[model samples]
Target: DRSARLPPYGKKRLKTCSFTFRNALLNIKEELQKAISTMTARATHSADVAANTSKNVAEKLDLALAIDKRISKLASQAIDYSSQLSGFDSGLATQMASFQEQMSQIKRELKEGLGRLEHVTANAESAGWYFNDCTC
Candidate 1:
């Protein structure tokens, strides 16, 4: 009703202004749609990249865990070998000590036997039974 009171020129100018305003609103809407589309595409790409990175990290983590397990197994084996070597060394030392004791005993017995042989030879010589004169 109030617009009906305007002069013809004013009405024409109002129509033109309304047209321009509508065009501006349409353009703004179009720009907003383009921005939304671009943002959605970027978001999708970021999500994909994140997923790939996560997968890579998981793989590396699995490999690290496997290596850790292997290292633990190797360490355990080393400990077992070290203990076995220690036991072997102890046994060898005991055996060596026993062998040395046996050698000492043998040497003492040999000396005693030599002394008895020397005494017997002296007694035989005093009786004039010469060993070098035996032909058999």
Candidate 2:
């Protein structure tokens, strides 16, 4: 949103757009095709008023379609490198969570193993005065 805050080379703002970067042009192209078909269907439309109305509608349709196309192109250019931009944050967070779980498991295992070692060490330290002095 803060395009002014961005550097000159990176003047992109991923705003809430009606059409996404990937499919806006295709959608505008489809709309233009439909408008052209509508115009052709009225080919037999005789009368000056009818022809004027059709031309006006066609011009409006073309203008709308051109605006959408331009917007789509600009957005696509801005977003082409956007795949790994903020998109990887989600995947990275998931991996970090997995790593943390693994680390916690290792810590638990170490704690258990250390508890066993301390028990053995305490028994060995006290064994010579109490047991049969057996080294086994």
Candidate 2 lDDT, tens digit per residue, 38-123?
88666645456688998999999999999999999989977875766667887899999999999999999999999999999888
Best by lDDT: 1
The C-alpha lDDT values of all candidates are 0.95, 0.81
Give all TM-scores, in the order shown. Answer: 0.73, 0.39
In the predicted model 2, the residue pairs found to clash are none
Provide the lDDT at 5 for model 1: 98
Identify the runs in model 1 with alpha carbons over 4 angstroms from their true place. 115-136
Give me the overall lDDT of model 2: 0.81
lDDT tens digits by residue: candidate 1, 72-117: 9999999999999999999999999999999999999999999999
- Please identify model 2 stretches exceeding 4 Å from their true place: 1-74, 131-136
